[model samples]
Target: MAILGTSYWNLIDVLKAGGDGIGDVVEALTQLTPFMKDANVITCNKGTKHVSSIRTGLPQVSWGALYQGIAQGKGDYTQVEDTTGFVEGLSAVDTRLLALKPAQAAKLRLMEGQGFLESMAQTMESAIWYSNVQLNGKQFHGLAPRYSALANGNVINGGGTGSDNASIWFVTHGDMQTSVITPENIAAGVQRDDKGEQRVMDGAGNPYYVKEELFTQHAGIAVKDWRYNARICNIDVSDVIAGTVNINALLRKAYYRLQGRRSYQMEKPGQVSPGRTVIYMNKTLAEALDAEGTNGRSGADNFIRLSPREIQGEEVQSWRGMPIRETDALLNTETRVS
Candidate 1:
């Protein structure tokens, strides 16, 4: 799910590292989704609390002869309630089997634990991506609905209604994108049963217990600035598959707008100045993009689907110098209207 270029942000690791007190549940499940490894994450300390972020509004100046102090422009602040809850995934293994078949049991235990964790991770990724698309969830609102309301200009239809390939790509900078936070007071970690408890096999002593849990909440996708983020909806999959639409051209347009944003020059003070760009797409769209790049046709400069290699022990592909990763969490089936 990873690609060649560097990620704009870091994935939050609640268990080993600290967070902005939000998105701990999802952060703890990073191993399940490789693309999530590149996302910026914050862990907070509460299930539901108001989180504030500084946003710069319009500034003013005056050219006076006497040199009197001009009125200072007060920056804007965005406060949103981040509410997160606990989600737990568990796996168990009998002790007797481990004691009897040392190596085999160890491998089986590792495999089972890994399988369970991967499933949970995918679930978390799906939830986040779905929310980003639908802009509505039980706990947090998503980006699609928020950006769609910004103006009629932001929500571009992919094609006609009831299209089979209804895909969307979210272009965003670090400044105006959605924020995920967790409560600071909550402890996000994995619990392993060292004690011989939850004995599944009566004669086999106790079974190993593993539990992973955390909470998360999402802030509004955009504050006062709406230009930093955009949505490319109603992308016809058939076009790319049939070699009609140019994937690189669409990406260029989105990335161009993202780079041209003027509000909130940086994500945070003392950080890098220029913003980071990301193209959020599902597997089907990603495949189409890959096909567009590798169609064996002329004028395809930024070819797609680079060789798969191990990056930090994880296998991933690359596209157009950016990381072209796949996540099943994104919705391939969507209805868009002109």
Candidate 2:
């Protein structure tokens, strides 16, 4: 029997499933960003908060003689509450300008709204990997903070000791693994509300009419099973540029770190099904990887394969059937993760 591939859903999927009217706008806004397009999203059933029960330890199994009594063992579990943060922005355009170009008034307002949407999309992307909820209570804890320690089981050290370092991430998006969360009863993605034209005081204390719109997105990150995600950190940028660091070898290590025999099991008795896994790197590392793919080095040709699959009409590279996506949210100037 052939196993079917996992189908992952993002914020736009959730919105469309719930019959939200802004699905097209959300798709247009996030289609250009790979992270936003591929991230798995879930709606909270507990209003603004969602709680997950994580299995920390497995039950002990023991063999006994016939008719002998055995001690019962229970699995250890912990509950974590994930809260969604509100990201809000206001777009206001001068009514006088709109009046000057009456024929293009709607276009002008739409252009202003596009700016707000683009900014919100970028903010959410950055927050997914770098936001620190402890320092800034308004934001949610991101993947970096959760896997910051090198000793963590899922964090793979790249042995880079410089400041110009980067990381490659392997994320499996699924309901039981990791996903982005939204508040209950709220439409997924950015919600826009037109406040109409209102008279407001300007910076010079002058009164004027301005068209106003409010944009808000409620989102957070949830790592239900942390083992499904892997991070290869501390890759030295200088070495990569000099053709010294072998990204393919690091990727192979990450593959084994994240992929297992149980990952392919789906909908079977006593088996945990896996999710769709994807790789993420910054532009610099992506280019380096491309260079390595065509460098004619021994055993390098078979490592990274350029896939025919197109994401938003752009060709995406792959490694072992997993798509490799590039996003600006990942920085090439990260400090060494020792």
Candidate 3:
């Protein structure tokens, strides 16, 4: 008789499960421009985050007769759902710079090790940012990709369908948050064996292994209410002030939409950051904002060019008192949509 064997989890599933946790973490080195640091960071401590939000489709009110019974409302009552979005799971950067050759540490005075650590940290941050907003071409359900501004269908065309000059993403600190399941803490000044396991040595060791604490980058955006954020797309900045394609006018229109929304309720008093709207765009779009109108004054004041200054330890630019954060993550040459 043949021996019976129970089939368990597949190897790929086992590897994925391991990657999702801290034990037996595998590190893969990837390179890209990091910009996730610019986003508002909200720390969380859960595998999946549950975001509760009220739907934008609220029921409409209707006029009723004085003596007769009231008529039924036209729209369905909006309900808040506990929508859950998964956290991004990417292995940490595991690398370091150290001279292991005998007497090499004496001659090698430059802080190459420190520089490598900084560069690695920055690269990890950028990768997280890219993943946060990037569209998943495959395995759509495996990774919880955040809402894409370009895919929102709300666009400002440049010349036509494929040419987009500028894009705008209005995001609030509450709209999303970056959570780190495992922090990128450095485990330096230690020696490791050839098998890449840490071990103590009485004296200096040759060809020492650079052992560092690598972590998994886990983050999720809780768009509890998407009304708090808006993406203005299809903006063709090169177009001359035509019948209805003025860039400056378009910007103002987008700004007011956020300002005028019932959820924003700008008229209400004692609102925090009422004018503290954050506008994120790339350098190309930033320049377009600078040249939106005939002159600086006529251009979108909220999109004007401003000098960078330290705001609460972070260097950020302010336009019309609102922060105009420049980020290359917001791609300028994006596939256009109607």
Candidate 4:
């Protein structure tokens, strides 16, 4: 949450490792969104998928006398495979148009590329939180689907019953907890390949020369340890806007739902050990939390305070020393999580 460094490489780190121009493209994408900037990204251990053995139950321990023998117990484990999804985009520019504006052609092509980059960023941001593999097998399952049921120990109900609802997520980014992943032997961020000018057919079946660019990103979400993440679902947006919902109270519950509290540690300067937690909500919910801090209402000082601080050059709001990031990916029209 505090931009700590871990053994795993983030999108920027992976792009920079190539020592080329791809870093510029990734930098632009991360700057445009909050999730991409803070997401912990790693390479998939298995070529196109990540296979992990999750511990579901602990072994039993018993005390015995010196002459007595005690039975050994083994911990329960479940294997989970997270498959990476390929998100690709293509951009085509008429070759004639480039020739018509020779001096401005490079700038024009760059502008087109930026548009595609932004679109891809938004797609990935939404998929990370809402994609359901059961509904569409081509996409990887996301956090919302995993915690869709109230029976899930980490999901907290916000008392909303209608469709005008949203969610607040407490995600711990770590190798053993959760992380964003890319396929093995592939770069992490969107890879851009320039396909030189070629004959492209128009909608009318006419053939013409056009320059093409392909953008491809192979990524997915991996929740290796489910206990490290929590979600507060069914928040009524109207109530929050009317200053009626006690968001700080729900935030407290979500915080406690996490199995581990001290999930992050500072090993050294510019180096972050695993286990960093961040709180995510939409803009409406974020404004509600800010209002609570300034309104001087009851219980506001206990767990909510808006002391804006700069982290990595961007102003960030914190609740109990954890960064609270706002994203558009969490919808306000979500159905209640029953």
Candidate 5:
């Protein structure tokens, strides 16, 4: 019914049945016996992986006693001699012990070479939309200016104060595209990309899945499509800035021209280039400058301060960079069949 005394085979059947539990496999291994001490006896069990593992638990027996079939002798024969045997003999024990090893555990050299190298090619993807957004370099989202429950007050169907409009900056490394989220874009591009299906939306007009929001700039948003060579590292960046930011500025300036308006906010300290939209980037600026493509590092959470010349000529760092490599993680015991 079961191979290797039904325990291992029964374990296999449980595994093959498309489900698993620790109790079953343990019971299987428990029923198996160890190998004989005779070197020859151990050799016989080495042929199959299943039988080899079973022999480890057996009581050790002497090589000559096992094969010669000696009877009780007095001086040393009145009873079995001082020689004690272990599970079928030392040979079987050795074979059984070897069976306990993982198929590749012994080949440490191979795992370090081909295995580790192949691992680097694999990509990990993460989502940025999970948290509050950042625009350009500042947090675009403050506390979600929640409106008190008014029976019905979510994303007011395009009625709030400039709440419906926002531009975003998305960052990710991929093929045919290094980044998405355009200066001309309004909401995230992927939002509301549901094809022919009515995607759900939240109270603030955000898509529950992010790819279903109905923002205008969603069209200009870029994405690294799923592909092989490019190695789909589809890391997502989903912070939104106002697309119509300049629109408000223009409206204010135009109102002044008509001699009837005032400004709400002061222009940022610097040469204000109105020609470039909020999200616009000059290739001159985006061009990477680094000896090994390391480029310049970026800061987050904290603001970088350009201290007075009296203190320092350079911009002082506000925070450290994110870790490029992770620390050693805890080792996981092999619980599943490879």
Candidate 6:
């Protein structure tokens, strides 16, 4: 069950793009639904003027946050490992010391989206992988940071002395990457196939048969839903990339997101502009504008911030009693006047 959080401002633009933009993401999750409980988490940028609205009935996890992840190069799709293992050829003292300091040092890089996902996966599955203990039989459990976690590639780590109890596990997915190396090393044993064929492991001290899914670890879900391991699914990369995938289906899924978010009655939670109106200004707008202006004069600007102040009290207010009003100019009243 994965909750995907993203910027809500992009959500409005997604809403404007005819409700289909988000449907794309929904379909992506839905296709994997058999294997996951997925939902999108849209973090709204309050600073952005556009209001967000649920366009589908699927559940959504929305919140307010600073929009930093939207910056370029923020989305990560890389796989990594930590120091929770016996150094293959390094001595115990050296390995333990090395585990204390991998890469000979550390260059902290803040992660987001998939990057965060991988980090968490590495941590979660690190012990299992480092020990070469096969959970189920297919995937090598690992750990990562957060946000999103799938599988990751595999690696090998072994040595008799310093690396005693050495083993290997299979890891998959790029999002399950991290580097929080634990000092203890798990030595389940070397990985092997059912037929007892030799296999290789990754640096995470995990191994695999070259395919992503872990045939055994995830077998229960796979058997029930068909997300089985080693199953080569030919999903149209272009379609997922275009986010214009099977429109009819995706839209229906998007509808789920739209409808589910409506349960909350927060004032702004349900806000959305009238796409078009026979009376450009609907009652809501007219009422709002009237309340602002009704106090003293005409036009939206007169009433919003400071009242006309009898026409000349403030630097911003012109003699209000006059007919021609510069009030509308105050629509962008970013500052205060007398």
The most accurate candidate by TM-score is: 4
Compared with the true structure, the alpha-carbon lDDT of candidate 2 equals: 0.77
TM-score of 1: 0.62
Q: Please, what are the lDDT tens digits per residue for candidate 3 over residues 256-308?
A: 64532322112336654332246666676666555553255443455434555
Clashes of 1: 23
Candidate 4 worst ten-residue window by lDDT: 1-10
Question: Once superposed on the true structure, which residue ranges of model 1 sit more than 4 Å away at CA?
Answer: 1-32, 45-50, 54-56, 67-73, 93-103, 132-139, 148-155, 168-180, 185-196, 199-227, 259-275, 294-321
What lDDT score goes with residue 334 in model 1?
57
Q: Which residue ranges in model 4 land beyond 4 Å of their true spot?
A: 1-32, 263-274, 298-304
The weakest ten consecutive residues by lDDT in model 3 span 1-10
lDDT of 2 by residue, 65-173 (tens): 9999997999999998887898898776667656655665676567557867888888888889999889899998888988898988889998789898899999887
Task: Estimate the TM-score of every prediction.
Answer: 0.62, 0.83, 0.51, 0.85, 0.12, 0.16
Could you tell me the TM-score of candidate 5?
Answer: 0.12
Q: How are the candidates ranked when ordered by TM-score, highest leading?
A: 4, 2, 1, 3, 6, 5
Better of 2 and 3 by lDDT: 2
Predicted structure with the largest lDDT when compared to the true one: 4
Name the weakest run of 10 consecutive residues (lDDT summed) in model 5: 32-41
RMSD of 6: 29.1
Q: Over the stretch 253-285, how does candidate 5's per-residue lDDT look in tens digits?
A: 222222111111112245231111111111111
Task: Report lDDT (CA) for all predictions.
Answer: 0.47, 0.77, 0.40, 0.80, 0.19, 0.21
The residue pairs that clash in candidate 3, if any, are 34-126, 155-233, 156-233, 156-234, 156-235, 157-234, 157-236, 158-236
